[model samples]
Target: MNKPVLDINDFPSKTQLITLSFQHMFAMFGSTILVPQLVGLSPAIALLTSGIATIIFLFITQFKVPAYLGSSFAFITPILIATNFGENPGNAMIGAMAVGITYSLVSLVIWKAGYKWLMRLLPPIVVGPVIMVIGLALSGTAVDMAMNVNDEYSFLHFTAALVTLFAAIVFTVYFKNILSAMPILLGLIIGYIYSAIIGIIDFTAVKEAKWFAMPDFLLPGIHYEFNITSSILLAMVPIVLVTISEHIGHQLVLGKVVNRNYIKDPGLHRSIFADGLGTFVSALLGGPPKTTYGENIGVLAITRVYSVYVIFGAAVLAILFAFFGKAMALIQTIPTAVLGGISILLFGIIASSGLRMLVENKIDFGKNRNLVISSVILVIGIGGAALRFSETFAIEGMALAAIVGVILNLILPGREIVQDEDEIN
Candidate 1:
């Protein structure tokens, strides 16, 4: 079918905007679905919350920014940890949502202090390795789960998992157009089919599962268990910091795409507050906390459709699909191996996003201070080393990396300003 024509210069007409909006919704589907699937939550619930959160995001940001709120991959490890600690998936999500609100509150402080100060504390070099750590830390989980799709003790499953993972990475790096966007989903699909043909996938659940049913919507049932609360906070807070940093970078990207300085105009303070508000709303509804997703940023960058209204349109579509339980069940049938394959791309893309930050900033690698900082960050972050003070003060990986980076950037003396091609142009 021929697509309808779209006018780029003017605000998209109502019908045209509606169509384009669905494009955005489709664009976000894989990652949004990926999170809930990984966390053992109801896929329908994830979709519903994401749609609601995106709409909330649009409303809170005054529908000025072309960003959507969805499941943040950053929260996955924390969520997994919380689950391991016996936090119910829904409650864990609520805790994460609370942490997101905390993040936004912290950002308000940063924005109030002037961006120059915040930049001094979190230059590209510091942020790059911190983000790198986030990706490297999660790589193990991807490999482990991908392998477990078959025999727990068999080396063959491990080999297959590695192959699937490698395929996803290769596709993400080399594939073009639609394939690139769906590297993880495609890889998972292919891997699942291979597994099913080989008699590996246990589809008994799929057979027993109803064609349509009400999704489990677990409400927040807070328990004052210290370990659970601390564990959730420890896992959630680091990503929240990373998310805040990402928020600044993304807002800048949105401003450039929309040809307005959103960072300074409506101001980062207001935007962060809006993000917090969206997350809070998502939590109340038993969904994962919302964050400004980079995937949507890529969509905006490609389409050049800057109207916030289009995103609102997307939000509406997302919410509608959330209510369609039948469609949600169909998505669950996709094989785990295929999903693992897709994650290979998704995870690597996340890591590379960190690399791109440094490249764009022209962060110098030759300086001894720079090399030491980066090296320390990668080693500490990836190695899972933690500095323990009191029971509550101990932290690991991304959180640890972020804290060290900020401190080093501030305490260390060499501060040379390097202009980038983007900045110069």
Candidate 2:
């Protein structure tokens, strides 16, 4: 099949450029919107912040990386656990800002010591399994969402969810070209059409919603009180650690795909700094933490359009969409079943990527230290082991697992895999 365009330097025809941009937009649609929905933040806020984030990310990186910023799935579980405010996610955003600062600090460390020290402190043995737990721990949430996260509409919801899941799988597996990169978008469309046909959608909100209304902007410090907690910080920061590792991988992948040494050109420290700054900005605006979208990267791989300009076009589209209240309201009407169906794949991908990290690194299970470290991290994270600080603050789930893993890796004897090659990244 003919692709739209390929190569970064190739001047794309106007029609091809617009098509490629929209493809990137839909490719990122499901996960980007889902993150805020999962954590009780505004989807409009997420979209708007992501647009602003991508622009800022581009500025910080000197427009070197052709990537779009979107809501990160890593913070979902922690946000739910850390913030008690149901509708107002002020505390959660504060916790998210802490995660970004943690990234900034890590960036500083990487600048001083280079990225190798990070591998030494948290190697694949610890980092890989913790990331796996991040995804696996959320399996229950996906199931609950698919079932409306409640008992209501059990039969109808489950059926709709099944249809959505099946459609996503079919689109992903059967459509092997550029289309394969868009299962989330396709499944969502299928869910929307199905729900409409079944009369499961309530359009009143959409009907009453203004087409040109602006997103409900949230200012964490000014509009809402910024609450901080050590425990919540602890719970959320580990996910930052995960994204740091992912940052390395993403840079490597993007560099390879674009045939440019991004790690050297933009430099890892600068890239991470930009990512941290973008994430912090997102949190300030009451959106989820921002991260580079792998979906857009996949689209780049398919279309062969490596132009950062194309990505900027997608960012503009996202901002426009964010300001369109009726469109966002319509999207909100999507059945929980639809989100549930997509979450299953999205979360599983996160877990599987971590497992792939271990496998690609050829982690030797025979090493008792490696075995023990991974075991502790996975069990604690998956089991929701909480070390409480007070009534409102507690370190549990991924954070607790990460702390334990680092301590165990440091103290345990016979764990000298620090000098391993960077073959995995």
Per-prediction TM-score, please? 0.83, 0.94
- The root-mean-square deviation over C-alpha atoms between each candidate and the true structure, in angstroms, is 4.2, 2.4
lDDT of 1 by residue, 1-425 (tens): 22213222356887878887887787777778888787776677777778787776666666666788887777776677666634566547656666757856776785667555655666788888888777777777666666564547445555555656666666667865545654555555556566666665666565666665666676655533323456556766666667777778888876666666676556777778877777777666666667777667776666656667777788888877876655666577765655655665567767888888888877888888888888888888888787766765567767777788777876877976644324521
- TM-score result, candidate 1: 0.83
Highest lDDT: which candidate? 2
Candidate 1, which ten residues in sequence have the lowest lDDT sum?
Answer: 1-10
Q: lDDT score, residue 176, model 2?
A: 72
Clashing pairs in 1: 184-342, 188-338, 188-339, 189-338
Per-residue lDDT of candidate 2, residues 12-49 (tens digit): 67887787778777788777888877777889988888
Query: How does residue 384 of candidate 2 score in lDDT?
Result: 90
Instruction: Give every collision pair in model 2.
Output: none
